[model samples]
Structure formats: C-alpha cells, structure tokens
Target: DVKVTQSSRYLVKRTGEKVFLECVQDMDHENMFWYRQDPGLGLRLIYFSYDVKMKEKGDIPEGYSVSREKKERFSLILESASTNQTSMYLCASLTVRTGRGTEAFFGQGTRLTVV
Candidate 1:
C-alpha cells in the first residue's frame, strides 16, 4: 500500500517559534498536500505540490509555506507558530492520474499544540 509518513505524531510549539513538519511518501505520487484540521472547521488546505521543486498555496496559506525539493519528500514550514495555529496537521498524497474516489493516502497526522 502507498504510505505517507509524517515526522512527528505530536508537536508542542510556543507562540512565535519557527516550525517544520516533514512528510515522505513511499509511492511516487505526483500530488502532495498539507492540511490543517480544526475542530468543527474540517480540513483546510495549507499547500500542495504537484511536482518536485513546485509548490502552490491553498485555502489557508497565511503564516505557512511549503517545500518540495525531491519527488518523495515535502515539508511544511510555519514562519511563527501561534496559538491559533494549533490543530491537527495532515499530510496526504495521490497519483497524478487519478480515478474517481481515488482517496488520498494520509500520514498518521501531527497534532501540533501552539502554546
């Protein structure tokens, strides 16, 4: 099975601290995404990369950025972690040529608590 691995299952960050969350995929999928899941708000996209060295901002890109230097690795960066930024961070990937309901493979998720 295709697997996405996240660096951390839980992260505690204080306000105004830089943070990096790593993700790696075993399958050579072309699409990767980072999303923040908040209570009642659901998952909101933070960024996505369709290819190596390429990145795109998603719905909630403010205070966050992403990097994809290699085909199998993607990273999410928080310039300054804030309390409001506290949420469950999810990393996911899918094939470039997708079929209907081809669900994305997800990491275990990083539960970040910005104090």
Candidate 2:
C-alpha cells in the first residue's frame, strides 16, 4: 500500500512566522501533492511535485511553496503564516502512468492553526 507520512499531526504558527510541513511516501510513485482542506472549500491544492527538484504550483499556491529533494520526500513551506492559512493540510501521491484514479493516499493530516 502507498503510505504518505506527514511530519506533524497538528501545528500552531504565529502570524508572519514561517512554517514547514514535511511529507514522505513509501511507494515509488512519481507524483506528490499538498493541499489544504477547508470546511466548505473541500480540498484545494497548494503545490505538487512530479520529480525531485521539480515543483508545480496548484490552485492555491499563494503564500506557499514546496521542495522535493528526494523521490520519496516532499516539503511544504509557508512563507508567512496567517489566520486565513489555518486549515487541515493533507499530503497525497499518485503514479501518473497508472490510468487508475489511484485515489490519492492521504496523510493523517496536519491541522495548522495560525494565531
């Protein structure tokens, strides 16, 4: 099974503080993604990496960035935390070669509360 592990289950960041959330996948999948889940907004992508050193901005990439220095590891960086950025952050991965939706495996999730 594909396992995505997040660095933290929860985090609290003060306004303007920089925050980092890490994710690692056991599977050799090529695609990794980061998203913030909100009540009515569902899951909005923040960033994704298809290969080491390659990163792509997702729908909601503002105030965020990412790093993929290793095939199995990905990181999300919040340049400046704000109350609006507080949300449940989830990490996922998939194999683009697979036609199957593969239902992106998710991390336990990091509930980030920016105060």
Candidate 3:
C-alpha cells in the first residue's frame, strides 16, 4: 500500500509569519503535487515536482514555494502567511505510466489557520 504522511493535521499561524508544510510518501512516486482547497474554489494546484530539485508553478503559486530535495519528501513553504491564505493543504504523489492511468496517493491534509 502507498502511504502519504503529512507533518501536521492542523496548523495555526499569525499574519506575516513563515510556515512550512511537509509531506512524505513511501511509494517512490515520480510526481508530487501541492494543492490548496477552499470553500468554492475547490482544489487549486500550488506547485508540482516531477523530479528532485525540479519544480513547476501551478494555478496559484503566489506567496508559496516548494522544495523536493529528496525523492520521498516534498515540502511546501509559505513565505509570508496571510488570512486569505488560510485553507486546507494537500500533498499527493503518483507514478506516471505511459500507457496506463495512475492513481495518486494523498496525505491526510493540513488545515491551516492564519489570524
């Protein structure tokens, strides 16, 4: 079974503070993604990495960044937290196959609150 673990299930931070969200996967997937979920916006991709030290910006990348220094770990960084940035963050990992579809494994999710 593939296991994706998030460092925190809930987090609280003040405005202008830096925050870190960490995720780990055991399946050795080739792709990893970071998404933020909001009430009506749904899941919006913040960043994704296909290989170590390689990252691509997604739908909403402002004020956020990601690091994939190791194959099993991906970290999301909020450079300066804000109230509007408060949302549920999710990390997912998947292996892409040429001819077949692949399922992504997700972390439990981290609900962040900024005040």
Candidate 4:
C-alpha cells in the first residue's frame, strides 16, 4: 500500500518565524503536491513536483514554496509565518504515468497555527 507521511500532525509558530513542513511517500510515485485547506476556500493547491527537482506553482503558491530533493521526499517552506497562513496542510502523492483509474493518496495533514 502507498503511504504518505507528514512530519507533523500539528504545529504552532509565532508571527515572522520561518517554518518547515516535511512530507514523505513510501511509494515511488512521480507526482507529489502540497495543499492548504480552509473552511470556505476548500483545499487550495500550493505546489506540485512531478519529478525530482522539477516543480510547478499551484493556484495558491503566493506565500509558499516547495522542494523535492529526493523522489520519496517533498518539503514545504513557509518563508515568514503569519496568522493568515494558518491552515491544514496536506501532502499527496500519485503516479502520473498511471491512467484515470489511479488515485492520489494523502497524508494525515499538519494543522498549523500562527500566533
């Protein structure tokens, strides 16, 4: 089975601090993504890395960045934490080569609060 793991299940940081959220997938998938969840906005994609060292900015990448140094690992960096950036962050992985039937698997998510 595919396993996606987030480094933290919950986090709290003061304003102006830099934060790092890590994610790893045991499955050798080709695609990994980071998304932030809000009540009204639903899940907004922050970044996507399709292959090692290749990444694309998603719909809500303005205040975020991502890194994919290894195929099994992906990291999300919050340059300067803020209250508005507080949300549930999720990591997902899937094999792009797979057809429509393939599905993405998500991690438990990290709930971050910026105070």
Candidate 5:
C-alpha cells in the first residue's frame, strides 16, 4: 500500500518560532506536494517538488518552503511561524508518469496552532 507519513499529528508554537514538518512516503513517487487547508479558503498548494533537489512554489508559497533531498522524503518549513499561518498541513505523493489520471496519496495531516 502506498503510504505517506507525517512526523507530527499536532503542533503548538509561539509566534516567531521556527517549525519543521516532515513527511515520508513508501511509494517511489516522482512528485511531492505540501498544502494547507483553511476555512473557506480551501486547500491551497504551498510547494511541490518534482525531483530531488528541485522545488517549485505553489499558490501560497509565502512564509513557507519545502525540501526534497531524497526521493521519498519531503520537508516543509515554516520560517518564523505566525498566528495566521496556523492551519492543517497536508503532504501528498504521486507518480505523475503513471498515466494521466494518477491520484495522489495523502498523509494524515498535521494540525498546527500558533499563539
């Protein structure tokens, strides 16, 4: 079974603190993505990496960044966390080359709260 694992299920941090969210996937997927879900705003992509050492910013990349050092591991970093940045973060992996209709497998997600 394809699985994506997030290091933490919940996190609470003070403003201005740095936070790190980690994700790993068992499937040797070619693409990994990080998204944040907010009320009404829906799921917005924060970043995605198509290959190792390569990353692309998504819709809402501000205050967020990602790292894909290894094929199966992707990390999302919140540089100086803020209250508005608090939300549910999700990590997903997919093999886009597996055909046009390939689906992404998602991790359970991490709910972060900033105060």
Candidate 6:
C-alpha cells in the first residue's frame, strides 16, 4: 500500500529555535507539498517540490524553507521558530496519472507548538 509518513506526530519547540519536519512517501510521487492548518485560515501552502532538488515557494513561505534531496523524501525547515508559527503541519504527495487525474495523499500531520 502507498503511504506517506511524517517523522513526528507532535512537536514542541522554543521561540527562535530551528525546527525540522520531515516527510516520506513510498509511492515515489513526483510532487510533494507542505502546508499548515490554522483555526480559521484553512490550509495554507508553505512550499512544494516537483522533483528532486527542485522546490518552489508557495502561498506562505516567508518563515519556512524546504529540501527535496530525493524523490521520496521532502523536508520542511523552520529557520527560526516563532509563536505565530504554531500550527498543524501537513505533508502531502501527489500522483498524476495520464487521463486519470491527480491524487494526493497526506501524512498524519505534525502538530507543532512554539512556546
């Protein structure tokens, strides 16, 4: 079965600290995305990668960066964690099939708390 796994399901970090959130997919998906979920703002994209070593900033990328060193792995980095950054982080992998449309699979999610 295809699976998207997150390194941690819950995390707590101090303000101004560096944080790493990792995600991995077993389906060898070509597209990966990082998103954060807030109370009323919904899910907002932070970054995405189409292929290995290729990444693009998404809607809210100001306080985040991403790394895709391999096809199956994507990593989100918080340069300096802040209280405002506390939220539920999600990692997703997309599979685009010819004439079949695209399907996205998401990890369980990492709930990060910045103190």
Q: Quick one: best TM-score, which candidate?
A: 6
The lDDT values for all models are 0.94, 0.92, 0.95, 0.94, 0.94, 0.97
Model 3 TM-score (2 dp): 0.95
Clashing residue pair totals per candidate (backbone < 3 A): 0, 0, 0, 0, 0, 0
Which residue runs of candidate 4 sit more than 4 Å off their true CA positions? Answer: 96-100
Candidate 1 C-alpha lDDT tens digits along 38-89: 8899999999999999999999999998999999999999999999998999
Higher-TM-score candidate of 1 and 6: 6
RMSD of 1: 1.5
Candidate 3 residues 10-68, lDDT tens each? 99999999999999999889899999999899889999999899999999999999999
Greater-lDDT candidate between 2 and 3? 3
In candidate 2, the residue pairs with backbone N, CA or C atoms under 3 Å apart (3 or more residues apart, or in different chains) clash, namely none
Model 6, range 1-115, lDDT digits (tens) per residue? Answer: 7799999999999999999999999998999999999999998999999999999999999989999999999999999999999999999999988999998999999999999
TM-score for candidate 2: 0.93
lDDT of 4 by residue, 1-115 (tens): 8899999999999998999999999989989999999999988999999999999999989878889999999999999999999999999997644466768899999999999
lDDT of prediction 4: 0.94
Q: How well does candidate 5 match the true structure in TM-score terms?
A: 0.95
All candidates: TM-score: 0.94, 0.93, 0.95, 0.94, 0.95, 0.97
- Where does candidate 5 stray beyond 4 Å? 97-100
Clashing pairs in 4: none
Candidate 5 lDDT, tens digit per residue, 1-115? 8999999999999999989999999988989999999999988999999999999999999998888999999999999999999899999998754467878899999999999
- Report the poorest 10 consecutive residues by lDDT, candidate 1: 94-103
The positional error of residue 114 in candidate 4, measured at the CA in angstroms, is 0.3
Q: Give the TM-score of candidate 6.
A: 0.97
Output the lDDT of residue 37, model 4.
Answer: 93
Show model 1 residue runs off by greater than 4 Å.
96-101
- Badly placed stretches (over 4 Å) of model 6 are none
